[model samples]
Target: MPLTDAKARNAKPKNNQFKLFDTDGLFLLVSPAGGKWWRFKYRLGGKEKLISLGTYPEVSLAQARARRDEARGQVADGIDPSQARKALKAARVQNESTFEVVAREWHTKFTPTWTPGHAVTIKSRLEFNVFPWIGERPVNEIKAPELLMVLRRIESRGAFETAHRIRSICGQVFRYAVATGRAERDPAADLRGALPPVKPKHHSAITDPEKVAGLLRAIDSYQGSLVTKCALRLAPYLFVRPGELRQMEWAQINLEAGEWNIPAEKMKTRQPHLVPLAHQTLEILRELHPLTGTGKYVFPNPRTSKRPMSNNAVLAALRRMGFEKEEMTGHGFRAMART
Candidate 1:
């Protein structure tokens, strides 16, 4: 007989488990503990098998009958419904594992080789750009279109280079997922030529000897602070990165040896660097030493003298000297010296 809701709900439990047969081997099993379970009794390859559809109320009589009909159709095609159910459940678990979960796991394994700042930057980039859009989606199920949509949002903000970098980062995460069996393939790898090209932008520099001379003359006559004036004067001689120069510590400079021994941590490459000081550079350092020698930084902030000089100090000085941003930046000294 087909089981109705009232028949199943009013069914009494006994000292032993009992089954109220519905039809075609679908029945409601009422346990001694008063729990009702919907189950399908079936046979495959002439051997008997049982599959649990769901519990009562959750799996109503009509829903259980529908599932039974579907399973019956599968059995008619000689497919084992129990095995099919197991595969579906496993797939569901895998899908719930999620992109964010796998990406974070990949990050944890990979961050050990990265510097603290680099690690923080990568995590921040993912959280800001990728997380809100599709981070919760299953990594394996994410298609190229979905990822391109994420990149497009970044592109819309005019962060073309950032979008490219994020694509690369996502590729790494996807590859990690693939290698670890969390995903089947990298969707990001399928997105070649999808983003805008990233052009290399070199810092503007005065490389011509004549223009360089003119720039030096302008720096000398600048009416900025004496400390800033000295930094501007010394920049051309040292020719290190602007941040490296501004964050320079007194201890790193060997005025006697005419060399600045930049520690690996302070350098962009994470490798120690040597900057040979010219005679004029030594004189400038010696002259400025009296003013900032006692402080931790060679070019301490003018307002406080407790920290390194502002990152904009040299750039602002260049602006004041009539060198437009396209003409020069604090970083331009490297190219100028290289030239």
Candidate 2:
């Protein structure tokens, strides 16, 4: 007879473990310790085998019988219920190892090789853009169409170049998943030319020696704050990036050695750079030293020494002196010196 809920609950343990039989090979195994577990005994391939359906109360009488019937169906179809259960368990484990989890792992592994700014940018892009859509989904189950939907949202925001970069990053992540046996293929690989092309922007610069001399003369006659004036004068000589020059510190300069050693962390190339100071550059520094030598930054903010000079100060000064942005920018100093 099939076990009723009231009888199963009242069933007590004896001296040893015993089985309370139900129809179709289903039974409740009552242990000596008073534990009641549902079990299904069956024969497959000329061998007898048994599997646990679940525990009493949790599996209940009706649910346990339903699971037993499902397993019996599989057995009739020449399938082993045990093997099918194992396959389902494996798939559940793989699903828990999601795309977001793998992508973040990939980010952590590769961030050490990138600059701090680059690392932050990459992380922010993913967290704000990609993670919300398909992050929780299984990496192996993420098809090309779903990934394309994510990229199209980014492209819709007018960040065409960023969309392309994100696709490349997704490809790297997918390839990493493949190497780790989590995914079969990179879905991003099929997205070639799927986004719009990036437009080229060239920084404007005046490279002629006569024109450069004229620029220097204009900077000298300007009546702006002395800090900005100093930066303007030093820009042409150092030819360092605007950011590098603005963040320059007195500690990095060696007056006796006539060198400016920029640390690797501050450099875009991730290598320390030595700028051999010309006599003219040294003299300019000497003149400005008495005013700002005690501060952390050589070109500290004009109003207060708490921060470095504004990045736009030099550009704004050039505009004040009647130079258009199309003619010369603060970054143009490098190309001008290069020419």
Count of steric clashes across candidates, in order = 0, 0
Quick one: best TM-score, which candidate?
2
lDDT of 2 by residue, 128-179 (tens): 8898998998999998899999999998889888898899989999999999
TM-score of candidate 2 to 2 decimals:
0.68
The regions of model 2 sitting more than 4 angstroms off are 1-96, 143-145, 179-181, 208-210
Q: What is the C-alpha lDDT of each candidate?
A: 0.89, 0.90
lDDT of 1 at 275: 86
Clash-forming residue pairs, model 2:
none
User: What tens-digit string does per-residue lDDT give for candidate 1 at 183-248?
Assistant: 889999899999979998899998999999999999889998878898899888877888888889
> Ten residues in a row with the worst lDDT in model 2?
91-100
Determine the C-alpha RMSD for candidate 2 after optimal superposition of all C-alphas. 7.9
